[model samples]
Target chain A: MPTVHATIIARGGGSTFHRKNTCRVLGTPIIAYAIQTCQQAGFIDHVFVWSEDEEIRSIARSLGAHALERPHSMVHYYSGFATQEEWAAQRGRQIEVIAGGPGDVNVAFNCNNFLLRPETLAAMHCQAREDEAVGGVIAVAAVEPGLCLKTRDGSLFPFWNDLSVPRAEHPPLYRRTGVAVTFRERFRNGRMALAPFVVSREEAFDLQHAEELPLAEFYLRKRLGLLDSDRPAAGEGC
Target chain B: MRVTASIIVLERDARDGVRWDARMGGMRLLEHAVARLKGLPLVDELAVLTDCDALCDALGNTLACAGVPVRRLCPTCTTERFDYLTCEESRIRQQLLALEQAGLAGDVHCFGSWRLPLLSTRSWERMYHALLEDRIAARIVPLTTEDPNLYTPLGGDVASGRLFGVWAHPGRDRQEAPQLYRPAEACVAHLGRIRYPQPLTKGVEIAMTEAVTVRTAEDMPLAHFLWARQQAGRACHDSQDGGAGVP
Candidate 1:
């Protein structure tokens, strides 16, 4: 079986950004969750956090995540796919040399969201075990009714109630949940992302804005009994 | 005649159907759990009971397709339409009475409609063993949790939690049946040795009644209580053997 390693591209920006994002998740940094989930998954072999910010490095290490000192040139916001490829090559080679053999087939995924049905991991493992050409398995969420597409003036329109489509012409709807993305050894080139399989929006959460924070809080408290209900009386510290 | 295990689900109304959510929206959070349990080799027989014909048919059909024989009982409606609390008390009472007269050796598991949290088949088996060890006659095993407000500590306030029950060592005679709501103390005293090999004294009855009342008030499911009883039995056995069971 191919060794599966998790590569976490932790964005290190302003302290305020980190604080704000972390507070949204009830004192849990956005990146911390990604790392925590990777640790929790049974199939993941190794986890590497790539970030240039010293604070991010400290936080990542404090959380028991393996931190890689990312190259400063690759830190530009607009660098995009170029940075990923640059980092992937260097990191992949380093890992390969360290092990005195071929590097891991890295399966990169976002650390933002929590898993609703964790059993999906078994499917991924099965795909890997059964098929060799499956570069990686990505989680996809089934399309909700409203998110359907429309073809008018060649522009994609979001479908809502009352819109009717023929059964034979029905579209197979799937949303790409950036929550989990996997890449095989041959595709571990960091400068680019492997063509990801689309996952459903229900299975993914992109906590980009402040309003999305409450959902994260609910996810943590419900899925994981992290918050102590009997903590100090409210309105004191928080 | 050898008897096998059976599952009895007490669903009062469609609102309390097996799919109803106690914690969050959506069908039984553990709806897929039955399949998960069937995958296990240890469990033998499984059954479900409900008031709604549709739900009963769906569950019965699903289990039947999977090659598991399940019995579904559509309780007769009382004055109110889908009034579960009343209809359930009436209908389930009959089933309980019938099972009591049969003198079967197998176990009976009763899960309430509001009980949404699902337990693994292995967990169910573990609970059965636990119940057998505890020698508990009746209690609820919460499949799903409810607002903690629905529960109370004996004298405490009530919350909307789920409940399950298991009956052990049933009686052969149904003529001297006791009322359902009879105080635990009274039931324990009058029907003490009737279910067990040895009769419990009035004092023991009161203590056991108090314990059951408190535990039930907290919404501990019948299966877990049975497990606790088993633990208590083990402890008693150890103490009798001169082990350091007393702490």
Candidate 2:
């Protein structure tokens, strides 16, 4: 089996619009949730947080994860200096520097999705170990745009163009959950052909908008079985 | 491990106004069940067991075109009986035994036709793997009540309604301290040793519904919402991959 190491990308949210990596969700920093998933996966030999923000890196370190400072040029979304290729190079360099010599498995984990399960990463590594020819495995959910609307030229029209159609008749659609991506050295020119690693519905929902924070809290409680179950419907039984 | 998935489609009174083979989104609930079974690489055989002629014919044609083999059976044990609940349970067991007799050996996963609309593959994986570890496992139905403080009531009183605390009983409390209830579906079993009916036997942990189901008329919105979520995911994937499904 190849050595496995997880690198959590904690940058990008430092922008004015999004929450920082140090933001807490359910008791732990959002970054720590990602770190915990990596730490729990028995297959992973090491875990590190790659971030440009010092506080983010400190939080990761405090959570018992190795911290690697990312280049500022790469995280500044407005700078436009770091092309996709350079970004990949920075990540690859970090991987090589932290573990050296292209480790067997490199998990590109984003700190935004704290709902990711450890079993997901473990499943990807198991698949990676079983088949060397496969390039990568990334989490994705099936989606179908059955009936939706869009506006153009000041008029609203069907987007998927299948309006008034039942969802079951809709085509098989899939979307990425943005939880994690696993790959080996085969990632070429900032691209890798990834096999879809399907995730559960709860794990598919990630944090983005401010309102989602409460929703995330609810789901977290639900997952932990801390949420109460006994409750009657409105207008039904007093 | 060998897996056999069975879709139960029985005829109900039209006056009841619930379609036994209703279409949600764009396909019939039965179609979702059959397609899900076909997608499972572990499932060796598929059976559409029902007394409903429409269900049998529709599946026969569907399976034929899909190049998948199917076994259709009409449940027997035509004995007359009173007490609707007992009859219902007995009939379900007979149908299961009938399906079992039709050569669907090994572990059997049963899904009510109405449930196929939104049960995701991951939920199936969870239940399947859970069954592998234990003798029996069920999929707990997660419900969202109109008010969080209210009891998570179900459409059919299929639940024993005798639960306390987490398993709230509708009869125990009327307007005060609304009881919380967790209604679960018998998702999987070792066919040889167990059979699933409306009220699960006993000692089964109630797992939150990993994949939502279309059980009542009230669930229509949730079904649409689930589709919307999937649509959103597809849009995200499209934007991320530049209009590609996956690389």
Alpha-carbon RMSD of each model: 23.0, 23.2
After superposing candidate 2 on the true structure, give the runs of residues whose Cα lies further than 4 Å from its correct spot: A12-16, A131-133, A147-149, A161-164, A188-191, A230-238, B1-247
Kindly list the per-residue Cα lDDT of model 1 for residues B1-247, writing each as its tens digit: 1223333344432232223222111223223334434444544444443444554566567667766555544333222222111113444355444334323123433232223222333444543443344443332221210011011112211111111111111222221222111111011111121233322111111111112211111232322232233345546679789774311
lDDT, candidate 2, equals 0.53
Q: Calculate DockQ per candidate and list them.
A: 0.01, 0.01
Specify the highest-TM-score model's number: 2
Q: lDDT tens digits, residues A90-121, model 1?
A: 66665564444333555565554444234454
Q: Candidate 2 residues A1-238, lDDT tens each? A: 6777787778746442365566666677777788988899777787878788887888778878888888888886447888766877877787677677566677777665678788877886776555444466656544434212212321112233242344455544444444444565666434454555666656766554443454455567667775432321111000
| Fraction of the true interface contacts (Cα pairs closer than 8 Å across chains) found in each model | 0.00, 0.00
Encode model 2's per-residue lDDT on B33-142: one tens digit a residue.
56655666667776665556765676567766775544555436222211111214564476455656756666555443445455555455555665555543322122
Question: How far in Å is the alpha carbon of B104 misplaced in model 2?
Answer: 55
